[model samples]
Target: MSDVNATSVRAIATKDFRDAVRSWTFWGLSLLFFLLVGLAAFAIGYFGNADTSTADFLGTVSQVTRLVVPLIALLLGWKSIAGERESGSIKVLLSLPHSRIDVVLGKYLGRATVLSLSLLIGFVIGAVVVAVMLSPPAIADYAGFIAMTILYGIAYLGIAIALSSITKSTTIAGAAMFGVFVLFYVVWNLLNFALQILMNQGYFSGVEVTQTMNGNEMQYERLPDWGLFVQTIDPGVAYANALSVIDAVEAPGFGTAFSAELFPSGVPFYLQNWFSFLILLVWIVVPTAIAIARFDRVDL
Candidate 1:
């Protein structure tokens, strides 16, 4: 592999972004997001309390985006590298001064940027609809939510791009994307249920705790700290739970309802809501880094 030149990476990223923006895929996704957010805003305005805060509105939107953003990002990246390889364009791309690292990194950045732009624009339009139906929402809080949602999409893009880089067939890349969706959305939830069952059956340890809720002493059994960590491993869970970390959303117990009341002593560092950000950052970095290294040594 050649040395990674920032200029080459930027040029490739620019080309990829232009290519994608011109395609139906980009505009189609934009329309989908526009409708999605517009609908969510309409629901809040039409059904929610007269004084619902921006945090409340965004908290609800986060639930939908948690799933939708990953799907869109995965689809965006599923063909990015594999389609190029299959069509023999990768050879032409690499024939330039760009390194394998440049291609992978550039592709990821370009796709991520496309997704970010689509999200920002969609949310802006959605926000207008929100203002019309309800009172104006908090701008800072909404911007922070948008930032988190963009990061969430980028994290999934890293995964899809990494998988695409390892294959020459778009079919395999697509299967990998579906597998990721299953792994996080299905298997992860089942795993949580399994953990709960094991804990209930005394096969796995459960943490016994007491807290005051509604002015009454309450007792509950929670999965152990490690088990709790397992739940946060899902990017969707991390994204929703991590919303509490930002100042824009001031709602209490926002971290998947895992609040200070849940822990009688103190929340473990790994269980802290802010840890979701670290997990997300890892998802973005680890996949791309490994893919770049492997792609560098692979035969194109």
Candidate 2:
């Protein structure tokens, strides 16, 4: 087994990026993002009153992005290493003095760059159009939202790539991607609901907090801090919660809103809005780390 070589990693990354850039998937994603932002702008400018700003536009678009970005990242990564291995191109790739670790790192860098560039193109154009349409707020916040969105997208991409690296079967990799989609969007939500049911049934404990909504005090049994941590396990939830931390969003939302109301006695460290970023970072790291370790030890 060869050690990771910087030059080899760079070569592989550049080649991978060049190859991907020429594909329809790359252009299609870029066009999709451009259209996503354009549509978001149209929605706000057409139906909204004076209160609408770029932040509102971002929040609206982010809702769609949460669903779209992960799917796109998964699709883009579905064939990354698995297809190459299936076709025996992994042999040819390794013959070029690139270590397996380099291959994983390089592929990740290449694809991550592709997604980031595609997002930048769309957001740049959208920002220009947004300036013409809405009462634009500070560009700093909008940039922060774009940055966070990019990080969110990268986290999903890393997960997909990690899955891609583990198996030689593209079919299995594709199935894994779908499974991931189901786990996060469906099962993750179900887990939260199930916890709520348990809390209501007194099977699980939660802090009863009184929140003033509609100027009326309403008592609610909120999830315990640990249960709340479980909800933030989803990348989308982390993205939204982190968005609130940077003031990129107006509301702290993702099923549960983070407010003093939810934690009258002060919020726990793990449930803090800023902690969501750490959660996202962990997702990005842990998956790839698993892939590299497992992939390296496995027979090609």
Alpha carbon deviation, residue 84, candidate 2 (Å): 0.3
Taken over the whole model, the C-alpha lDDT of each candidate is 0.87, 0.87
TM-scores, all models, native as reference:
0.93, 0.94
Q: Model 2: number of clashes?
A: 0
Instruction: State candidate 2's TM-score.
Output: 0.94
**Which stretch of 10 consecutive residues in model 2 shows the poorest summed lDDT?**
249-258
Q: Which stretches of candidate 2 lie over 4 Å from their true place?
A: 135-137, 251-256
Question: Residue 135 in candidate 2 has what lDDT?
Answer: 62
As a whole number from 0 to 100, the lDDT of residue 72 in candidate 1 is 95
- Please, what are the lDDT tens digits per residue for candidate 2 over residues 44-82? 888988888777887788888888999988987888899
**Can you give the lDDT of residue 200 in candidate 2?**
89
